[model samples]
Target: MAVSAIATPVAASSGSFLISPNVGLMLWTLILFGISMFVLWKLAFPRISEALDRRQRAIEESIDAAERTREESRELLEEYRERLREARSQAEEIIERARRTAEVHERDTQAEAQARREQLMEQTRREIATETRRAIDEIRREVADLTVMATEKVTRKTLTEEDQRRLVEEALGELDFSALAPAREE
Candidate 1:
């Protein structure tokens, strides 16, 4: 009986419509699938597409902002480099000006020192000339007095002023006084 029952169920299942192709069921399944697709297209598809579009726009805006920021950074970097170059040029110019000023100051100082040295040398020469003249005059007076005294002693008579003047003139004319003067430098 159990064998018969199992054989009967297997035979019935083998002839069942579920295992065989049925045009009615296929048509009904197709109709249900189309209805479900139409419902999703009308309700879920628009919301999903709108969300995707919003995401795409947000991504594009972020990219645009990043690009703008990169361009601004590039501009700022260029500006900084330009400013640095200007600063270096200004620094070099300042150094050059200072160098020129220092050179001028050095030259002026040397020239001033040279002028002072020349002035002092001229003053010393003048003083030496004045002293030499005074010494020579003193020597001349002494010699004149000595000559008068010797003349009076030798002649055994007092010489008059005229005789003394004549003798002194003759003695002064015989002496060479040029050697007493200082030699000129140039």
Candidate 2:
């Protein structure tokens, strides 16, 4: 029994006293596994879960805010487009109205000018006709007197007043002077 005890294996040596046997290694492994489980349950698992939850909430909030901002911007763009269209229509209408007004004024001015020109022409024509009549009457009287005097000189006879008048009137009637005259004056 003493020899068998001496031959039995032992992890510790008589000279080196730092470690003992396989039981200590088993105890260390069990203790390390227990501590790892405690850390995961008490600190690591909860912190990881909390971080995941916070990240999910932040992503959701960001998406909602982005959607809201996009909608507001779209509405503003639509409003601006409508206003621009309305202003363009109004500007076109104003321009058309101004063009119509100018045409009307131009027509009125032309009509007035034509009427004034017609009036002036008519007045000038009347003055010309009056002057021509006066000229013809003066020429007729002078020619009548001249013809009577020439008859008296050629016949060498003193004629009666009625004879002289008739001869002079007949000679004046033979020469027509009424067809060659201007119808208007300046």
Candidate 3:
């Protein structure tokens, strides 16, 4: 019994909370602590936590910038569209003004041409009436001379001054001098 007690003194010490230096438990404890630290730093802390934080911040910034740019682009497009509409209205107004001016110009030119034609036609008619009157007078003088000669030949008698004048007047009474035809000089 005394020899068994001496041999089992190490076992008896194990029953206490203290451990011996001769056991390899210290090495196991160090290995487990190193592995837990490695897992925390390499897998848990750096990969999931920091990367998630960076990604979330980046996404938020990108969304904000995209919204601002979209608003700016929309405003610019609206401004350009307004300018286009204004230009179209201005162009239409210009065309209408030009059309009105052209119509006025055409009317003025046509009136001028019509006035000129009327003046020329009236002047030509007046000239024709004057020429007809002069021609009728000349023809009457020639016919009277021939009649006097014929009368002297046929009657074998010379007419007196009063009879010749009366005969010539009677012959001219049948003709209208105002409406006489133009004389052709032979």
* Backbone atom clashes (below 3 Å) for every candidate: 0, 0, 0
Q: Which is better, 1 or 3, measured by lDDT?
A: 1
Q: What's each prediction's TM-score?
A: 0.62, 0.44, 0.42
lDDT of 2 by residue, 1-186 (tens): 344354445425573333333567869999999999999999999999999999999999999999999999999999999999999999999999999999999998999999989989888887887888888878877887788778889998877899988897798779877464663333
Instruction: Report the lDDT of model 2 for residue 94.
Output: 95
Candidate 3 to truth, TM: 0.42
Local distance difference test, each candidate: 0.89, 0.82, 0.82
The pairs that clash in candidate 3 are none
Per-residue error for 166 in candidate 3, Å, reads: 20
Candidate 3: what lDDT?
0.82
> For model 3, where is the 10-residue window of minimal lDDT?
14-23
Sort order, TM-score high to low: 1, 2, 3
Candidate 3 lDDT at 91 equals: 100
Clash-forming residue pairs, model 2: none
TM-score of 2: 0.44
Residue 52, candidate 2: how far off, in angstroms?
A: 2.4
